[model samples]
Target: MTNLDIPATPGAAVARTEASPVGRVLAEQAVRTAAAWLAEFRKSPSTPAAYARDLGLAAVVEHHQLQDLVEAFPLPSVRTLFTRSRARGVAPELCWFPMLLDLGLHPVLDATPAHVKGWVALMDEHRDATGQPVLSPAARARRVAALSSLLRWAVTEELITANPVDRLDRDRAGLVVDRHHSPTRGLSGAQLDLLVWTADRYPGPQRARTAALVALLATTAIRVSELCGLATGDYFADTGRHVIEVTRKGGKRQRIPVPPAAAARLDAYLATRPDYGAVAVPGQHGAGRVPLLATTAWRPGAGRRGGGQPLSPGEVWATLRRVARTHPDLAHLADQLHPHQLRHSVATRLLEAGAPQQHVQDLLGHVDPAMTQRYNRARDQLHNSPTPLAGQLLERGLAALDQDQEHHPAG
Candidate 1:
């Protein structure tokens, strides 16, 4: 073979390190390095990391860095981060949470068995009245999505080289298609009349206030938060029509024209409005004034007050529940009624009344015209049922047959 050189085989001599567990320890260290980087990235964002979060977890989640993100970003703990991501406003979840800890990251990414167990325990505590998990099929999906977001945030922060949750079957983890039928199911006309009559059954300021709150929800379709968030300034009376401006989700604002009945009730309530420091600025007028809803709980500059102060969401819900129990007509409607249902009811009624789609969309502050179309389509089904018309035609056809029978008298 003379001086011919031989090419070395790929695995000819694998270098064997005599150091026991050296390879394992190095791999472990690499994982921890990635995890620590991820944690910092979540608090502080980077372009590549953010892109990973967007692509891997959720579409709505925007990247935020520790420097740029709010100090009170509300990402306090892992649980809170999950909850805020899932619950705040009507945003969708990212899909990377279910398994991100599997990748090597330090701190946030290190999957302690205790952490998983604690999450499962906490989730179990969120059951509804029926004791079925309140984090229903839909909610579980949202939770998973939220988890995915945090993991993706980890990736964005460079905690790991790849998204651990990238292949997580979000659909299997309860993130399924949401088909929401409006649960407006408000009081029927007669039922509403009965509720009013029941309200009238009580006397004095208590009756007035209760009636006003009920009327406000039913008529304005304002959210419970917006209703409770109200200050005297929210209502405008002098301009031929009364208008109440409500702050909705996403910090969006909408001005709803209140009917005379609700306006009258609101006026009555305002006349008795106590000084929770929620007065209207006389000359300025409309929408930009203080919050329409206020409670003594959040009194201006008051140190702190608990339940002794004015109403909270729970307080308002409880009070409304009590009112429902008092009235037979409203009793059935009470348990089902929420402040949001009032908004849905208003949207439904408006669409039913042939209100313009654009008008409804604007009134509801829907970001998309398609949302208004949904209500319009539903309203059409309610008022314009073809089945009923078909039934009437069938009856008329039978009547003609009856006349022929009388003429022929065939056995």
Candidate 2:
């Protein structure tokens, strides 16, 4: 490894060129911080490897993933590679994160342009036994973005003045990763209606629960993990409005306002559930607050008095699949539909209705304004929807307003 002396105060000439030392402890801390950052910025729509190609949250994520190539590289030589001890991913949301995180033995400094170029060359040339390619071009791009992310964060904390990775990123070709325009694919309002309607008509005690689940999935747009975390005690209602107190990813609870229709569905479901703090009994979630939604298997155990347990994520998916399967129109989606897709569907609807991007971002817990803009842009470029018709309506409305002003001659 080549050592580049880092100046105490990096001058303008060496600002983006200097290399500062990063000890094993700092590298490990960076991984933890990077993970928290990714979770907070997960809703950002841009791909760090492709679109931004610079220091950003996505860039951190994309770059950090490569830090864990520990199996391929030893910890002592490449301390910069975050060896993750043995955990594959830092969080469940990002299981794809390479498990190569560790508090390595040496110090890692800020990457220089030469360092980035060297890393790229290694990725391109290095191959496992049998000459099989290890990191694909796309994978390499992701890790580069990941590295950029860490350096960018380092810069933010004033740990580094600039991210040298930016210098080499411009020279690299085919560094961009292929990305889907919209992960929702496109959830039309009609299909969303069918999803809710199908669940609503379910002929069982859990019918209301399923209906509420689908409705809230589309309307509230909470993550499935958060949905499953809901307890009977979480639903807060007042004379003015109804809201669900959702436990966010880090156990931070936030009250998300629910529309009247969805709230009504929730009430209908709770009408059949056991009271909060149901009597002590086995199979109950915690012998505490009952789950807002329960599985059919969670019957009245022993004396039919126990509070049913929270519905598992698997159960939620099963219910969604059942809803899709029951409706012939939605049958094709049975294998493809997921709860998160509905969240996207909600964003689409909100943007289509001309809601402010910031308001929508707040509603969805998106930290980046770029994601909100992407959602609007996706809706704007819709070829399937009646965008042309809407344009025609606008033109006609403007002309009608002009004629009315001329005829009426308002004072």
Candidate 3:
């Protein structure tokens, strides 16, 4: 076997020769193929880079002799692939590499249709670090779809004769794997109230700031990352409505309307800061580049150097968790609650209160209506009542008995 030379950087171009190791050649070809496909498909910049890294790792694990590696690859599986991949900083999607490694299926030339179905079964029985099932049915389905895409690309390139994954009946797979729509669990009204109350009464030095942060999260449904990225200039009163301009996922800018109560809490929190009034111009209200949620680590001698640094997503999570841990009412949710749950809660609350699906979709900044529909379906299921149907049946049966007794004059 020839010694393999892996590139230090994924973006670096490598010159290949006829003498180059089979694994290296295969890896380079796969990356080139993926790049060409991505260019034509116009995928996000990060997609090609990630695929290059992942495929390169796959090449290394197989030692470049694709045919021999696939036939002899361990079936029951060990963590060797994962450990090696991590050392090279080429961690693929969770369980993706391991599943492939365990199957030892050749990507292009050798793997058969039965091998693909066997892989599906393996994923179904796989366990996580916590001893729970590794992938939910939906998650498994997504992973399969991703794998199928890659294989289909290989087939188009004529590297493979056919795409075996395409032969697997999707409807049959769905029947075998129970596909349930798992709704995002959000904080209930009581949970939200308790969280805010706890934050307000926190004895920590950053109590007021924490209170405001919780209030904003509960009301706005903005992601923690977006909240952390906010600048004071982003918050302003527009036409009698308090609004905050935020950059959502995928760099989309959105103006989210803040609730009056939450705005008041934010104002009170800002008033406690010495720089708030100084930063604002006399004519313009809420106009400054200062971070809306600045770090609490600033001290007098720090000389404003650390003052404007925004609270990180980790800090936001820790703050909420601290409040949940301290409050008796929220103690049960201490382990389960997080900032994203607040987003889910807001979405659910809006749908339950008769908000239009499209309006909620816009509020959440979801590009896909299907995602918004999940929230609507969950709300509908929650409110659907069996009592009405049961009540009608009972009433009809009782009325029939009453009429018979009256007509027969039973004594």
Candidate 4:
């Protein structure tokens, strides 16, 4: 391998020594640090303390990955090493792994613009392979977010001093990722009545209970995950205000306020709740707290004396399916329905009603107002219950174009 000199960078100077063995050890440390930091960031959200630790780790990983490249080939800089490593079938996420190996043998790897582009290409490949571009808008946003977090870590570690992914530019492509448009898809006046009627047929104690769950999701716009996480004790019975505490993706908690109608549904569900067993302690809201939803198959066991354990989110889907199957009219509507669609339905209704963007953001636990605005946009594009008139118009336009082509006779 050619001897590579570490360029002087103010206070940060790479030591160039003849001792290749010692240099290799340093590179290994760098690789380990990068992996450790990435793992830590995955476990924790973007906090000052978390970023600090990740920065230290990024430095280690970048050094090692670069060292491995230098030791294997006559690479002059970190950028060349990254290119050579990528050509050897190394993915972007695993770029640190190879870079760390190279750094263990050298002082520092030179990261260049060309090499950074190569890294970005690798990231794009991995993203496409893992169903990012082709997935739902929500899923695509989530994947981009995950990749951004790792790239940010690289920035703090001074691996490349800048996030290359941030430099990726996109042109006008129909709709931006995070932007919300008002949706035309919502239950019509008659369909809404049908849904309520079907939900009401759940039989006895299950009647009001099941209908309430669906109604609350539509009216309150709370996430289905948050709905399932609720406990019977989450409500203030006397005040008639139900507070739902939700833990979002990054372990951030947002408390959503439930309306009076939702509160009444919850109260009704609580009233009909069968006596599973005794309360372990007074006002312990955690595990010992009464489960908000339980199944008929639920039974008391070793630590669980309650009649039913807390219902999993899957139960929510099953309950909806059961109600849909029981009612013919509702079956047509509910067959293609998902819990999140109900959330979209509610958000659309609220935005149409002229609710404040900030209020919607707070209610939906969205980190940004832009995200909450997509629903608003989607709502405007279509009315409540998209009519077939637009479809008919599209067909007529296509027919007219075909007739014009026949008369023109291009051949």
Candidates' C-alpha lDDT: 0.44, 0.52, 0.56, 0.46
* Model 3 segments more than 4 A misplaced: 1-123, 128-131, 138-181, 271-291, 296-314, 367-370, 373-411
- Best of the two (1, 2) by TM-score: 1
lDDT (Cα, tens digit) per residue for candidate 4, span 1-411: 211222333332344343555554665544444344434533122232223222232333343445443333221122222322232212323343233233232212343334334433433344465576433333333333444565566668775576644654422211235455533355543344344445655765467668778656655566665676556554442233345544444545544555554556666766666642333222334435555665444332213323455554455776677776776666776656667666665655556656566566556656656777543121211112221221222234435545765899546
User: lDDT (0-100) at residue 27 of candidate 1?
Assistant: 32
Instruction: State every prediction's TM-score relative to the real structure.
Output: 0.53, 0.49, 0.54, 0.50
Estimate candidate 1's RMSD in Å. 16.6
Model 1, residue 223: distance off in Å is 2.1
What is the model-wide C-alpha lDDT for candidate 4? 0.46
Question: Which runs of model 2 end up more than 4 angstroms from their true locations?
Answer: 1-181, 249-252, 277-289, 296-307, 373-411
Residue 410 C-alpha lDDT in model 1: 50
The TM-score-based order of candidates, best leading, equals 3, 1, 4, 2
Predicted structure with the largest lDDT when compared to the true one: 3
Q: List the residue pairs that clash in candidate 3.
A: 23-64
- Sort the predicted structures by lDDT, highest score first: 3, 2, 4, 1
